[model samples]
Target chain A: MQNLNKPNFKFTPLQIVQISVTVFVILLGLNLWTFYAEPLSKVLSPYWNDNLIDILVLIPAVGAAVAGTLLTRQFEKGETPYHIWQAFTIGLWFWVAGEIGGMVNDALYWDTIYPDFSLVDMFWLLGYFFLGLSLYYQLRLVYGAKSRSRRRIYLGLVAIALLVSAGLTHLAIKAGLGEGYAWIILFVTVLYPVFDLTEGATAIWISFLFGRGQWSRPWWGLILFALADSVNTFYWLGGYGFIPVAAQTVLNFISVIAYPASYMVAGLALLSNYFILRYGENSGLLKVAIKSEINKP
Target chain B: MKYFFRQIEDIPLDHSPVSAEVYFRGENATGLIEKQFNADRVAALLFISGTPGMAYLIEASQSKSISLAEFSSFADGVSHTRAINLPDVAGRLMLLALESKVNDKFTITTEEAWDKKISRWKQEQRSGLVEVKSKNLHGFIFFWQGELQKLDLIFSTPQGFVSGFPKLNALDDSAWDVTTYVHSASAQAYQCTVLRQGAMYWCHKILVRYQEMVGQKLLKMMDRELNRQMQPWHWNINLNENDMLDTHFFPYLMDEAHAYRALFMAMGAQMNFVIGNNLTQRLLSETFEQIRPDERAALQSQRLIPAAFSE
Candidate 1:
């Protein structure tokens, strides 16, 4: 509860980067170790815990939640930009709640991976509502100012995304993952990738428009989040082994490594934004204020 | 910040008996009035007879009561409740003399009538000041508490400036233009006082506070952006490194409130571009907080600036 406006009050940008990278590595290693360790030795067996990864996601997710609160509090609440960011923060909190729900699921039923549908999925899916709102608001703000070429470029990029997602889905269906699955289950599972792709594409466009501007970095986190979620969508559809038997060993050896890491990275991005706006190195207001003070006659 | 001053409420009053040095500033009589009052269109007069010794004289206007709503345009420069004490008789005579319509030749001889009226006004127990203007003399006759009190004079001779009451024989009155201001001896007394200056002080404070709270370095580095934003205003003023306006706002004497508001808003919009709206607004509020509470109160009362001047 140090004063928020004081110069250099919190973590530096380097420290934020270090924390994100460290958390990502730990999440990835633990997730990979769970799948890879059992084949190697009993020594690693005692150390690996599948449920721990579910709980560990809260570390970054909660950090993201705190960053959101600061963002909403520090910025002018009535502004359109802040409203958009507030929507994004709400989406992030929904994801955090989903992670917490997953932890509860793991604690309650040690054997089950997840029920066909559960409250956790509901939380994660609801997060898309807020993410969609934020993306829509941002688009509306920049929509009027965009040139014809820029709009065409956005549409072309989106079309390209659609083709890539279609190809990935085709690969899963060709491997028979979609063959006997219930239509409802397939539809629900497909929704995650759809939302992720839309969010990622819109974020890319926003970043492009704001180049070297204030909003440039905030959307980058959502892009990372979308990528990780896309990979998880395949895992959920049981498409891992569809590539080939030659790659089956590595395929089966991957145990949800990217999912938590993605969440951590997203959280790290939000934290970094909050820190940079108020106190992070090279960009914080306090440092600039001090510099101005020094330069004065 | 959401403040505006449609009408100037306070005329910076020099209540003390002004010294000859401070009032005339050693300038020759021909240019003294123009230098002091013409820029802001504010005319101030001081009389030495009364205890509360300020005779505020607003130059005569066609519309004695103009709406403060038109204060933004400041079409005629002087429009405020304080101006409700319209020039009347005394105000007109001062204005006519200051207008230099009569340098030395005039046959409107009120000399005999001037002494007679003073005696009559004393008998009637009327309290006010009489204004006498001539080619070389700007004379004031003070009446305090229904009594003839003092003679204060400023001699605007080509020989140079001389001040203070002249001896009885020293006054030669073949022809004179004389008028009287009947003091109401009530609360509605600040009518003729014009308030056309002091905007520079507020503008300076805005810059200094912004420098201290948010960092003027950001504004200093934005030359291209400032020029781009200010292109519409077409102003050629002295804006310093901190984006502080230095004394070039005199042209806005009639509408200083709106003029400075435009400057304030432009700088604020630039800050938003740099840091974003939240911190920009927060910093703006902090900068506005630098103004003293009383000054802010006065400004706000006239809608010159917002309650806290927050964005």
Candidate 2:
């Protein structure tokens, strides 16, 4: 008899993709129905408030957090590297913070002139900081001590890019909001997009370094996330008609898809990453398939 | 003709069976000899050990069924009880006696000298007739004095026997002794050694160099087998002190079923356990009892051994 105490909970790459895509589609469908579908919107009009959207977004964020925690436990049990779990945990925590902050705004119905630069915005900034920190740690794992100079150069390049983007965002925010806006509101608004752009850039860079052959799934997911975040920045700017009329018209269309797509893509990336760590070709969880394409030289 | 000799009781007087019925001795028993006897019609002898004056009975029985007194006379004539010096030698004598008892048409000349017989046996080994059967890593069994003996498990590879535990060089001469050759593959012999701590069999140890070399080889093989670009050694170098001591080092031992599974995967082989003989199955159960609770639990968690192997 096989031992009941020891359970082999392993999944294949195709299975992982299938499960993740299904979850993503269901969540995206629900979000679309809540916003755009009139019949369902009327049915959920009372129950599906902004607070419900907050919980809906929180589901994936919290699920990623839980998956990270489980992966950490598995690392301890199986002696796998802890850095993979740590990266997801840190990134998921940031998402949780951003979601919680949004949930609070919807729950309390805060009415301030510059809602963009409220206490909730501070949490969002802190969330992005942790997400960036997680990526930095991940980069360190990829490039060990031998490439000290190269890592330094990479970090320097990221800093320069972040600064240039931040400067551009600051100028755009000033032009969009007008001189009547407080300096603090302008600074916070500019910082938000800058954090998102930095995270997107970092994800792309990491994907470029390690993503090849069979490892392309997570890379594709990261690229989608980066694109979604880039589109989201324009959506945020276009909300107040700060963007030019021509760009605003494009932003309005992009915003419809990009906002929900960002969370879904990020969730998919985290799930795919978890599978890679837990059941990758090298993980010994699957039967040895010498003839498989992944095993080809 | 070269013969592989082992002791067996209750040989059928009516039937002339070609194969040998040798009882499982220990890990050191010649697996190649057993396989040859089973596969080909290689000659084999089975006899009881510790019987008094049995050598004389064997020698005289070549011509006729000699009386017990004549057997005693033949034994008394000899200056030494040659059979006592090496009880295994009696197996050769028993074969000669059996040939006489059967009154076979062909006359077989038995080598009288003990050293000559041993030399002949060694010569027979190189003839390519002997085939070594591959054993599952966990199938090692040892028996002494009709009782199951606890043994230190060793992994048999083409190079040599890989000891599962580290040996301390400070041990005295009496503490260490090579027990027997266990299993072999592709004409390569894998030997098993017993380490004694006073009266108790403690732990098994292999050559430190062989251990390290095999570990390195397995790592490289695993990388190739999995088609992994990043090697474990590269990651292992950067591992923190805690991970190095606990997680990574255990698999290097390779005696544990979990470690064996990893090594076999590298070799592109799947590991499965066979229960072997009934005595060994019981002894293995007892050996499992000797293991620490946590260690036993860890082995159980790997689930490498099939339920049939345990039975």
Report per-candidate DockQ.
Answer: 0.04, 0.04
CAPRI-style quality class for the chain A–B interface of candidate 1: incorrect
lDDT of 1 by residue, B59-141 (tens): 43111222223222332433322211111223222332332222222234554555676577678865444555554454444
C-alpha lDDT values of all predictions? 0.49, 0.39
**What's the residue-level lDDT of A293 in candidate 1?**
21
Task: Compose the digit string of candidate 1's lDDT tens values, residues A160-231.
Answer: 655665665666677777787665565566667887888887887666655533445567667777766665
Ten contiguous residues with the weakest lDDT in model 1 chain B: B1-10
Error of 1 at B147 (Å): 47
Please write out the lDDT profile of model 2 over residues A35-73, one tens digit for every residue. Answer: 555443465554345555566667766766665565454
Tell me each candidate's i-RMS in Å.
11.4, 18.6
After superposition, the stretches of candidate 1 with alpha carbons farther than 4 Å from their true spots are A1-48, A108-113, A144-182, A233-261, A272-297, B1-311
Worst 10 residues of 2 chain A by lDDT: A288-297
